[model samples]
Target: MRTAYSVETVRAAERSLMARLAEGALMQRAAAGLAAACAQLLRRVYGSRLVLLVGSGDNGGDALYAGARLARRGAGVTAVLLAPERTHQGGLAALRGAGGTVVPGGPESVGAAEEAIRRADLVVDGIVGIGGKGGLRPDAARLAALVGQSRAAVVAVDLPSGVEADTGEVLGPAVRADLTVTFGTHKPALLIDPAREYAGSVRLVDIGLELPGQAELEALQHADVAALLPLPQAESDKYRRGVVGIAAGSARYPGAAVLAVSGALRGGAGAVRYVGPAGEAVIARFPETLVSDTGPAKAGRVQAWVVGPGVGDDAATVAEVLGADVPVLVDADGLRLADRDTVRGRGAPTVMTPHAGEAAALLGVSREEVEGARLAAVRELAARYRATVLLKGSTTLVADAGGGPVLVNATGTPWLATAGSGDVLSGLSGSLLASGLSARDAAGAAAYLHGLAGRYAADGAPAGAHDVANAVPEAWRDVRG
Candidate 1:
């Protein structure tokens, strides 16, 4: 699993390591890694034009030292000092000694920096550090705007300028980098959006910071998911494997039932028992499904239940499913119908899957707020309902009720913004729950598989919910390998 620590945690770790090392040794280690990464990106370093947006902190020092390294390799480097008086003296002296040109960042010197930016092949952004709260200063923002207009490939040092390292919030104007070379470990901003969108692609350059065993956030890779995947044992029968019960679909939205069942069949469940008003429609599409028009009470026994999707105004059905002594996944309309107290009182684990709009409704906020601060929103929802919360979007996040590490997944394409996508995900998550995975693991692993399946189904084109469901096995096999 890939992990990210908060700014405070990172700083503590850095201080601990710095105490053991000689003065300036840690900075030099960081500079060496940064310069090496920049050189690799440039390919041919000789005679290449580079611009460093130098500000006042250690970030500025990192840029200057890295620039000095490139200058020694014959790259023509220009340092645009945002705060000339407060700039790192050691880094400035090093750059000047290595034959780098310096441009003062004042109103009168803006044109000079603009000229260098126009001719630059790569722009290194070191305007603000992780401690930076809201946006950029006026002077730095102007330089960032200029860099945005230029054709240069921008690389940010540590965290991107003007983004919250801990919360992943971008308040105002921030530097958008083509690649960010982060030292030590990842920050929440690098993984969570809308700051994640600002941090284009990330490259971690470890500088040997001794961190705690647990991280604030984590993103599961293929190996991690593969280890958690539920496979059939030789003695396992259909009942032994676990049966998933789906309480979804309505008379008007019968397609939701078929799509949910489709996902369950492909999701490693032995059998899917679907109970809704759209039984005939579900059976017509998937004959393997044990369709029932009766409520969840008479639907035999199931290891897990997935409610909502196209249930519309069926509050009773949602309540009935919630009452069952099994792990439950609530999505779509069920998010609105389900009571908070009742859900919290449940003996078994419950997973809530909500889009931005649904999450906004649950939180009594606007959709824009949830989208803007996804990490905060998901964490809040998980705490409020005392259940595992899965907030779906361009980046899918799974937050556990107890809140150890929030799981982040960025494996799907934008084409996944299709209709009935959530329905498919609901079934998959419920199936994983039935197969004996915890709410957090089930939601995170399901999200990982679902995103990959969407990518396979789309294949650079548009795909329906059915296509995504069909691609689940392929994603499973790919992960296992």
Candidate 2:
């Protein structure tokens, strides 16, 4: 599990670690890590021009010290100091002592910085950190614009400035970095998004901050999710494992039935029973699936059920699925049609999967609001509906009804945004549920696997739903092995 602590927790941890060390020790450790990362980036590009956008805080100190390291290593290094008087004194002295030049921020400074950035092999962003509030100041904003417009690889010190370190909220404009080398533990913003989106790739730099309190947020990496995946024993048979009942697809959208069943087939379920009008189409695509035209109650001994996903706006189907005594996964059209109380009152585990748009509809908010505060949105949904909620998108988040550990799925690709992809995820998650995983684990594990399958199917090329489904077994093997 990748843990993310809140900003206050991080600060306290930093204080604890700093108190044990001599003055400048923590900063030196951070600077060394930053400098090493810069060297690696420089080696890849095969050039020596490096520019540091310095602010007035310790973040700037980190950059200036790093700049000194590069200057000593045969690289041309320069610093564009946003606050000349308030610059980190030790860092400034180190840079100047190492033959690095510090330029004031202005039109001249901007011109020089932009020119250097255009020709530079890498740019280091130190404009802001956990101490910063709101968006970038005008000068820092202008510098960020230049960095964004430049072709040089940009590495952020700590985090991309202007992003809320606590909430992953971009209050206004922010820097988009190619790599972010964060000190100590991971910040919630680095793992969640709109801030996470700005943070292209995150690398944690251990400064030995002894953080306080439990993690505010968490993400499941490959190994973490791999451990959570369901595995069967040699004595296990189809009925003995688990059976997943799929109540999806109406006559209007029969393709949803096919896609949802396809996902369940690879979801680690012992067997899948399809119930509803689209059973014919589901059977046509997956003849191995046990098909029935009966209601969810007559679907016959299912360990779990997947509801919604192209089932149209049928109130009856929603009612039947909700009334069942097993764990139910609500998705797609079911999100709009189902009753929250009925779902909650079922007394069984319930998992709701909704993309930003669908989640917005469920919460009576705008999609932008949901995207801006995805962590809060998912948590709120889980609390409100008293069910496990999975908000699917670039960064998929799974939260339990009681506000337990929230798991973020980081394996998604833009290619997985195609239609019917969500249906597959719902089926896969339902299968995990049938296989006896908790709602939160099932949802998170399914998202991780679904994303891996999507990436494998695309393989850097464009892929459709069928390609994603076809890659599921391979993805499972890769994880289980």
Candidate 3:
């Protein structure tokens, strides 16, 4: 699994490592990695026009030192010092010694810096450090605009400046980089959305810092997911393999039931028991499904239940499903009808999957608020509902009840925004729950598989919900291999 640490954790690790090393050893490590990454991107570093936007923080120092390295290699390096007096003096001296030119970029003067950025082959953004908060100052914002207008490829030091490293919130003008070379460990901003979008591609440079405790956020790799996937034994039967109960769909919206069933069938569940008013529609589509007009309790021997999707105003069915002794996966309309106290008081595990809008409604907040603070929102929902909560979007997040690391999935494409995608995810996640994975594991692994399936289905063009469900086997094979 790829891991991400919070700003506080990263700082502690950095301090611990710095205390045991020479004064300039840690900074040198970061500078060397930064320079190497820039070199590779430039391809032909020698004679290239490089412009470094240096601020007052260590990020600027990193850029200054890196510029010195490039200068020695015969590249024409220019450092635009945003805070000349506060700049790293040692790094500034090193740049001058290596034939790099320095220019002032104070409030009164910026013409020289603007011209350098426009003419440069590459632009290095060290304008703001990780600890920098809110947004860019007026002067920095002006420089950011110049970089945007220029055709030069931009590389950000540590992370894209002007984003909240821990919360992944981009409040104001932030640097958009083609690549970000981060030191020590990955920050939440590099993994989560909004801010993650600013950091085009990320490269981690090991500075040998030992981070204590678990990661605040984690993204499951293929190997981690493969280990969690269930495989059948020789003695396994339809019952032994696991049966998933899907209490979804209604008279008005039967397609939701069919789509949910479509995903469950391909999600490694041996039998799917679908109970609702949409039985006929589900039967017409997936004949393999065991259909019932009865409620979830009468569905007969299901390992887990998936309630919601298109069962609009069906409060009775949602209540029945929540009362079941087995694990339950609640979503869609169910997220609206199911009682909060019932979900929180359940004896068995409960998985609540919601998109940003649905989550906002649950928390009594606006959609924008939930989307902007996804990590906090998901965590709060998990605790409030006493269930594992999966927030679905550009980057799906799975958070367990109480504490521990939250799992993040980024395998999806923009094509996954089609109708019934969340329904498909709900059913798939329910199937995993039936297969005996914990709420967190089932939700996380299902997201991983669902995202991969979406990618395979879409390829490049748009794909429907059915296309995504049909691609599950491809994702499974890819994970196993």
RMSD values for the candidates in order, in angstroms, are 0.8, 1.8, 0.9
Give the per-residue lDDT of model 2 (tens digit) for 1-481: 7888887888888888888999999999999999999898778423388889999899999999999988988788889988898999999999999888878876666777778778877889998879787989888898889888888899999999999997888998889999999988888889887899899888899887777668887787778778888788999999878999998998899988889999999999999999989977888889899998878888799999999988888879888988888899999989999998898787889999999999999899999999999999999999999999999988999998887657887887999999889989999999999999999889988998999999999999999887898899988888877
lDDT string for model 3 (1-481, tens) is 8899988899999999999999989999999999999999999998999999999999999999999999999899999989999999999999999999999987666789888998999999998988989989888889989999999999999999998998888888999999999998899989998899999899999999899988999999999999999999999898887999999998899989999898888777789999999999999999999998767777799999999999999999999999999999999999999999999999999999999999999999999998888899999999999999999999999999977999999999899999998889989999988988888999999999999999999999999999999999999999999
Which regions of candidate 2 are displaced past 4 Å? 44-47
The per-model lDDT (C-alpha) reads 0.93, 0.89, 0.93
The ten-residue window of minimal lDDT in model 3 covers 105-114
lDDT, candidate 3, at 438: 88
- Candidate 3 runs further than 4 Å off: none
Worst 10 residues of 1 by lDDT: 261-270
List the candidates' TM-scores in order.
Answer: 0.99, 0.96, 0.99
- Please tell me which model should have the higher lDDT, number 1 or number 2: 1
Give the range of the ten consecutive residues with the poorest summed lDDT in model 2.
40-49
| Model 2's TM-score against the true structure | 0.96
Count steric clashes of candidate 3. Answer: 0
Model 3's lDDT to the true fold? Answer: 0.93
